[model samples]
Target: MKVALTGAEGFLGWHTRVLLRALGWPDPVLIGRADLADAAVLADRLRGVDRVLHLAGVNRGEPAEVAAGNVAVAEALARGLRRCAQPPKTLVYANTVQAGNGTAYGDSKAAAAAILAGAAAGCHLVDHRLPHLYGEHGRPFYNSVTATFCRVLADGGEPELRDDRELRLVHVTDAAAALLDAPPAGPWDAAMPALRIGVHALADRLAGFAATYRGGDLPPLTDRHDVRLFNTYRSHLFPAGYPIPLVRRADHRGELVEAVRSHGAGQAFCSATRPGVTRGEHFHLAKVERFVVLRGRAEIRLRRVGGRGLVRFPVDGAEPVVVDMPTMWAHDITNTGDGDLLTLFWTNDLFDPARPDTYPEPVAAA
Candidate 1:
């Protein structure tokens, strides 16, 4: 469907754009803050748009400015939509959970929602009262505590949390998905999937992740939320803190080193492959697997299930490197050297005979 989105440069808007593209939706016409200030520009942009996602607002500014800015943006959008030849079939407003509170931001959001509902005469309006949203690349010290914490920890600084307020955080991706998945609405209230935790607890969890990950160890990914949080935390450390060198202990008897460490890891196994032999040719839906070559040389190949290109990584036992397999990606390893290959494999979950997620698929399509 043709979509027009405001706040396209913001954190949540960026994720929504990515999700829409991943879902094969048409590229949205982005309406920036300046465009919202201009009725003609906004109206022109909304001309043939099928859906309108209104996500622009001022969260940080003078109290009066914040309140007026939000309401004005809503009013501008309403006016633009009314001027359109065909109003969008759906108008989704990104409201906050604080809309009912007595605070200035809350009052403004509530007012904006009301304005949109009134102006969206024939169109479906869905108001999502989202909670504290967090994800990769969120602006630090702006609104998200997760982003600030990640920034401080990644910069080798301590995050001082004076107020241990309870926060219900929803990943930006999940919020975007919820917006796309919501059905046509006539003034409905909804919330995205969130993880509720105290500020102190959240800080402690992130601190633990930083310590473990910096030490070249994989932190415990007990649940999907933890995994998402870990990924978000790591995204803050991009370009640096990568290619973590593993600690290797060597002796006259032989060298021994820990390949992977995870509090939630369930199973570990080792495999031996003869020269010119290949292993794996399959993919998993949820399992997290790591392949580490212990002896001989191998080439690990991976390709997304529906993708055409394959990614190949040559690994050797002389210098161990762990290659993690992503979900929905068909992967395999082949013995590339003249000698036999010895590989160690670790997975987050134990192999279940009854409900195996492994799907046979060639990494290289014929």
Candidate 2:
């Protein structure tokens, strides 16, 4: 289906794009700031699209600025829709649960939703009221408290609790799913389900992750929420926390090295690849995977899903090191030496065919 998106570069927008890529959908028509400011341009971009996910609005600024900015963007969108020769079949508005809660931001969001609804005469309008969202690559101090705490913990600092209120949190990917996977026939208004945690409790959980991860061990990821939180924490540690050198001990018989240290259950295995061959041209949504070169020279390349630029790492058995793959990154290992390459692989979960959680995308093309 042809889909168009506004605010396609924001944190949630980026995650939505990543989800679209994971679903094998064609790239959406990106309605950026310029297009949103021009009625004709926005209308032209929206033309012929099956769905238009309207996600543009201001949430942080002076009260008057915030209020005006939010309403203004929605007005522009409404004007654009009026100019469209054929309105989109579906219009998904990324509203918030806080909408109409008497705050400037909340009131503005409610007004914005009303504007879009008024403009969407014959469209299936899905007003998705998202909860507090947290996920990989969320901007610290701006997106959510989970992101701010994750950043603080990753930086070897303690999170200072300012408010201990409860948060009903939803991962941004799930929020994106709500927008993309809405029912075909709907003029419904709803909020996504959320995971609840108090501010202080959330800080403590992240603190535990920091303490466990600092020692090169995987924390206890006992559930899906835990896995998502761990992945969010790991996002702040990648490219710098990788290539952890294994402590090599030499005695009489042979050198003994502890490759992986885990605080939870997992699967460990190895692979042998011929020289000049490659393996693993895929990305995982929630799996924590590790690569260690036990007996050959190799290179591991990773590119962020739905993005450009490759992160490269060279490894050798002589000085084996741990390179853990970050979730949502397309990665691969290539035998660079003339000899056969032996590499150790470890994942926090046993392989399940029905829920593989793997998507194929070339690192070179990312």
For all predicted structures, in order, the TM-scores are 0.73, 0.95
Q: Cα deviation in Å at residue 219, candidate 1?
A: 1.9
What is candidate 1's lDDT per residue for 249-360, written digit by digit as tens? 9999988979888766668899999999999998754466778898999998987555578878888898887777765567899999998899999887777775565767
| Off by more than 4 A, model 2 | 182-193
The number of residue pairs in model 2 that clash at the backbone is 0
Model 1 weakest 10-residue run by lDDT: 182-191
- Can you write out model 2's per-residue Cα lDDT over 1-366, one digit (the tens) per residue? 889998889988988888777777889999887987888988898989999998888889899999999999888888888888899998899999999999999999999999888885687778988889998988998888999999988888899988689999888877887899833222111234577999999999989988987867788989767888899998988888777777899998989778888888899999999999999999887788999899989999999987899999999999988899998899999999999999989999998876677888899992
Model 1, position 60, has a per-residue lDDT of 94
List the pairs of residues colliding in candidate 2.
none
Top candidate by TM-score: 2
> How high is the lDDT of residue 113 in model 2?
90
